[model samples]
Target chain A: MRIAVVVFPGSNCDHDAYHAFKHVLGVETVFVWHKEADLRGADAVVLPGGFSYGDYLRAGAIASRSPVMDEVSRFAGKGGPVIGICNGFQILCEAGLLPGALMRNRGLRFICRDVFLRCETSGTAFTSRLSNGDVIRLHVAHGEGNYFATPETIVRLEAEQRIVFRYCDPTGRLDPEWNFNGSLEAIAGVLNEGRNVLGMMPHPERMAEAILGGTDGIAVLGSLLDYLESLPLKGGKRGEVAREAAGAAQKGAEGTKGASGREAGGRCKAV
Target chain B: MEETMKAKVTVSPRRGVRDPQGRAVLGSLHALGFPEVVDVRVGRFIELIIEPKGEGGPDEVEARRRQEQRLDEMCRRLLANTLIEDYRFETEP
Candidate 1:
């Protein structure tokens, strides 16, 4: 299947994503410029990592408003699968496609290291290949990867099982020290309400090839292909079934609805 | 009317949010024997020189209204991340 790698003005990982999907996975891939208004009909989309617009004002804040984001939002509104890594995750949150925000790292340092991520759920299209609680090692490189959201939103995400991954030790034990960033609930990755979009701080493409370092990322990429293959052609009886699955994944997003209604007290911040 | 205005925008992390830089400074102070320092929060400020929008100097009330509106838009859309930060602005003509 064809995959689209969106290249923002300052995105540096476009080539890496292209290599992972085109060489490792043997899939057709194209580099879609951030200025482009459409996806050109790709089966899947990947928002690669980088300092878009030099991360001026705030990380991912500027890039999220690029013209391409309009179509990206529409594509996500459908059942198309989307994966955002590192800075891409920040963009997703800024675009309102994902909940919460990425704050400064708790240690106030730009951390770059391999960390273990335990798959919290396999219910979404992004993690269907892995069983729950499976651990994968991925590289994380960023200064503002600490995720924060209201307590109510965290509870909703937990109840919906949308937290696809959490920081943990190799043996699958979640320890505070193991959390590279002070993300709430030690969240390493999360799925949107529809479960088709995933935002994670780790760079899976960096670990997708054995030559690079590891092959753990294969599972994550492989699962996307599997999920894509499982869906039938658009506008058919089989398509109806796939749509139903997507519908079930759109759990209630309380924060998105009550941003102004909720009092700002007690909401956790990174300090 | 044309008028030159200086606007100062202050952006700070919302309360209950983590401020690693602020915490680091606080630690440094404590280590330097400034134990009385209770708390410290780090933030950023931006100075903007707003150019005249029209031919002559605008009326005082109109200039203040325009400056405030522009500053709010700038903060909301670019200068600050509303999700995690709050911003306040003051202008002088």
Candidate 2:
């Protein structure tokens, strides 16, 4: 599938993300500068992690308002799939495309290391290839990976099955040490209301190859390709899906609908 | 007559980085027996003094406004890391 990786000043991972899709996944990938307002026919978009705008004024804050974000928002509004990793995740939170905010590490330090993530859902296009409760290894490098939300928002997220991934131990158990940045409820990642948009702290592109010590990230990227391939050859436009998803998300939030399968507030309860 | 002009600026986190200072301050407040502390993030407070120019001397209000604009440029270009900080300015005459 064709993909676009957004590039902003100080975004160091854009290249890696582009190469992973181009060389590893053997797909056409484009680098869209932050100043650009168009997606250029990309089927999906990835916001690579890095110290965007030098991590000034709160990571992702300045970058969130960059010109390209307006396009990203519009693209997602039309149902195009978008993924934000590391600092990109910070930008997404800053842009309000996803719920909750990312806070500083509970340890008060920048963390750069590999961590284990437990997949919490498999129903969406992002994780349709993986089974629920599957464990994957990926790299996380950030100081403010901790996620926070009001108690009510947390409950709503869980009830909606929006909590997609959580920090976990090697054996798939939730542990404090594995909870790298002390995210609220061990949250490592989450999905926007319609599940087409994903924001996660870990770098899946960094783990797409076995030579990189693992290939678990392949499934994540592969899932996108899987969805793209599943689309009908004719009369299947992406913009329609994104718009529908955006509408559904607004409705979901307005309705205060409960999560599909999980218990209320259970996903983010302190462990 | 003496005229005085001053500008005050503050810089803070944009929205994403975990504000450890804010959280720590909250924790400290709780430890200090103040349970009302919920959120806190450390930021910078800067004060600048501007002297009037010319025979009539600097217009306090005008000088303060000019200095405030300059301070904003400084924050966006240097003083504050825009990626992680947000800033504001106040002027006094």
Candidate 3:
């Protein structure tokens, strides 16, 4: 299937995403300029990482209002699979396509390193390849990756099981030290309520190849193909796939309701 | 007669949210022996001039009302991320 990588003016990771999708994953990929109105017949869309618009007003504020976002929003409304990485995640939050906001890091430092992420819930278009509670390593680099949301929104997100990934240690421990950006509950990635859109701080494309340090990210990237293959060969009308996925996620959350009595539980109640 | 209206907007992090930069500044102040400064917060200040849309401006009351509304919209839509930031504006007569 063909994938479209949206390129903003200051987007630095566009090429990395292109290389991973085209060279590594062997998927037909094309670059769609920020000003382009149409998505150029892409089955999936990726908003790659970068300081779009120089991150002037805010990390993703200016880039969110660019001309092409209008199309992206429409594409998302149709329940299309869209992945926003790093600054792209910030842009999605700014554009109102996702819940919560990526505030400045709690330590106020630009953190750039490899971090471990636990697959919080499975069946998502982005993480369908992995089983629940799997740990994967990916590189995260950002100054404003601290994810924050209102207490009510957090509750809703948890109840819906939209939290796709959480920071963790190699042994899958959810301690504060593993949280690279101090995101609430160590949230590294999240899915929109519709379950089709995903926004995350870590760069999966960066880790898609073994030469680049790790190939663990391919599970996240390759899930797109797996998801598309599972859907009926209709013209991108896979709303049922998303619904079934969300149903599984909700069940997973219900199954683990009383099991996780850790810091995340305390923080949730404290809110 | 035409008049140019000016506005000053101040944007700051929402209370109860962690402000690392502000905390760093507070630490520096404490190190400098300024114990009197119990709290420190960082914010942004922006100023802009706005002209009425049509050839001539509306009456003073209507002009101020329109300007205020536009400024609020600007802050909500672009200038500030209301989720994590609070914004206030002052319009000059």
Residue-level lDDT of model 1, residues A1-271, one tens digit each, is 6799999989998899999999989988999999999787687899999999998878999999999999889878865678999999999999989999998898889999999999987635777667888899998899999999889989988876778889999999999999978999999888887667899999889999888889888888888877766765566443344434443333222444423211221110100
* Predictions' DockQ, in order: 0.72, 0.21, 0.89
By DockQ, the candidates rank as 3, 1, 2
What is the lDDT ranking, best to worst? 3, 1, 2
Could you give candidate 3's per-residue lDDT for residues A1-271 as a string of tens digits? 7789999999999999999999999988999999999988777899999999889888999999999999989878666679999999999999999999998898899999999999987756777778778999999999999999998989878876788899999989999988968899899888876567899999999999888999998999998777666655544644444434434443443465523311121111110
Local distance difference test values of all predictions, in order: 0.81, 0.78, 0.83
Q: Is candidate 2 or candidate 3 better by TM-score?
A: 3
Which candidate, 1 or 3, would have the higher DockQ against the true structure?
Answer: 3
Runs of candidate 1 with Cα error greater than 4 angstroms are: A234-271, B55-63
Off by over 4 Å in 3: A235-271, B55-58
- Among these predictions, the greatest DockQ belongs to 3
Q: Per-residue lDDT of B1-93 in model 2, one digit per residue for the tens?
A: 145667688888667556777877888899999997777878878777756544444565674456566678877755565545788877666
Q: Count clashes in each candidate, considering only residues at least 3 apart in sequence or on different chains.
A: 10, 26, 0
TM-score of each: 0.87, 0.75, 0.89
Interface RMSD of each: 1.1, 6.0, 0.7
Worst 10 residues of 2 chain B by lDDT: B51-60
Model 2 ranges off by over 4 Å:
A236-271, B1-19, B22-41, B46-89
TM-score of chain B of 3: 0.89
